[model samples]
Target: MRDNQITKEFFDWIRQGNSGCIFAKLFVLRGGDTPWEASVIRAETFDAPTVEAIGETLKLASKRSEAIQLILPNIKTPEQIARMISCLCKNPNWYCTEIIPKPSEYTSSFLAGLRWKLPDAVNVNWVLGFADIETMPPTRRAPYTSLAIRLGQPGTAPSVAKDKPNEVRSRKKENGLVPVHLADMPTPFLKDDAIKKTWVLTEQTAGKMLNPTPEFRTNAHAKVTFALPMDLRDSLIGCFTPVAMDSKSEIGAEEY
Candidate 1:
């Protein structure tokens, strides 16, 4: 009876936009069952909205015993970013976002070296061996992050997640259970490079991001990614508009 009430109230709180870290700590500390089992139970029972609201909490529970996800920004080409931005324009939420690092040697010939530089501060492959970010307090996590480390070492790769948002969205019984992927988007802006040129965060800023900073970097041979702390996600999204002619606007600047 007590557990049932606790679970119900936790989901309610999350639906109201309260952070899930408090309940997550309790779940991690006292629950008799494994976190993944709990997550599956919730996934099976809750409606879509409830699941989405408490997604991070469920993710936190599922990852309590293991590593949480990590972010590797700036890994995509102009065309890839444009495709993603197009998808995001229509459906702002993606169920799972993958970070598959490609070597710089694979880059285009003309702008290969000048376009991007891989992180120099950390061993970008440590994640392949260790697997996961330090499970921080759950807020809204970025879908299901699958960090792909391409080394051929056995047991060194993260498995692709089975239960992603696309599957869940298609499974509502009303819609036919056909998955919708990024590639399915019909009108991706392939020519857009403006956003790429203006991206600001670098390895220096991104390293200070997570709760407990990681010891090593991902072994990316090219420009992997750049990101900010998750708390500012909403504010950041609000600023994702077209850059004006000057492109010199700073935070709180009148010109912006």
Candidate 2:
């Protein structure tokens, strides 16, 4: 199927309120310098309200992270800065293929708080990126944290790419889902040539991307879940405006 057609189908699926369908939001950052850099700062499943709230947060965070990158000589790579922000944000869903740095005293507190806040059922797969074997964690533990390495050779690093939010938004509009992009919003962060964008995938689309073949069905009994860490939740809640609902009205209520 064509890319546009697939996007249309995804939008329709989201609109239909299909069971097991979730909206996966990805925050992508890219740079224009010679040694190119691109990284996904945050990726999480969002309910409608959380999506808008996160868009605003991403604008602020992107600017802040970039500024910190300029000041901190130790933070050279996008992945390094991303990891630092992940710790500060206490975002458990932060994905990185590189070796995550050992948390500093300040960041360690954030990491511990996040680990403590994790629900008993949620599992974290920790990938060690260090070249030295001695730095690796010795064992996996509960809340199901597993120590491992990212499989396969690392792919070529992502370079600065053109903004495609409009294309995605138009495709989504054709099938009835509202598409939100960081680029369209008014913010000081977008002044630079860096790439800022967000795209959502329905659970069905996410499944196809993860496991494209009919023969490779994921176990029906298996459960996979992700939770936002405490710090991020607190930060977003502070910024989010809650909509008031009438006690008597049962219709038009948002359910997560």
Candidate 3:
């Protein structure tokens, strides 16, 4: 499907008021390193009947993943990370989140504290591998002209003169620390020319893709079994087992 079509379908699916699990998978197509790699990182079973519930689920999943850290590594403070993630939750379009340094961190304790937060029937183990992505392409090296313009200007407060070499090195790091512009931020999943896309699928649609038949438990297990080094396939398969229904009889019994 076209990228725009997929995006619309995703939003529409999320708006449906069905009581079932929802799963989101992120896919990235790198230039030369790897053609494509994906991870099913977010899943929620909602009893509430509202589109907002779906948004809340995704926001919570994003928070649990610590997604801001993936895009901004220098933001070491926890409060800052929380605030940034909060902002993204409100306006995911105002800024973007990327998985930097690699995707392994998403699986490593990404769901550690989530057990108590989720409904008992909703299995957390269903999520595979960490959702973290490797580092954003390094900021393009700054130009010499820009460096000269920045260094030549004196600080707002009075300061003693330092050696040119030391002064230049310090200013270089300072200039590089400027926050990256939203437009300049690297696209994590698509080529430079390809259109970026996202999709949200209901559990049934996702299941069809991941586990089409009774024989296969999950699509991830079938397609990327080797990629999952944690070896949690058996546990994941167990989680997919259908919940049984109660067999209570409705007819009243007569007493002699």
Highest lDDT scorer: 1
Q: What TM-score goes with each of the models? A: 0.17, 0.18, 0.16
- lDDT value, candidate 3, whole model: 0.22
* Tens-place lDDT digits, model 2, residues 218-240: 21101111122324333333222
How many angstroms is residue 107 displaced in model 3 relative to the true structure, after the best TM-score fit?
Answer: 14
Which residue ranges in model 3 land beyond 4 Å of their true spot?
A: 1-70, 92-256
Model 1 TM-score, all chains together: 0.17
Q: Report, for all candidates in order, the number of backbone clashes.
A: 10, 1, 12
Question: Which has the better lDDT: candidate 1, or candidate 3?
Answer: 1
Angstrom error of the Cα, residue 175, model 3: value is 41
Estimate, for each residue in 21-122, the C-alpha lDDT of model 3 and write its tens digit. Answer: 221222111222211111221212212232244335434543333111111222333233223233323431221122111332223211110011112222
Q: Encode model 1's per-residue lDDT on 5-57: one tens digit a residue.
A: 53444334434432222222333344343121222122222244643443354
TM-score order of candidates, top first: 2, 1, 3
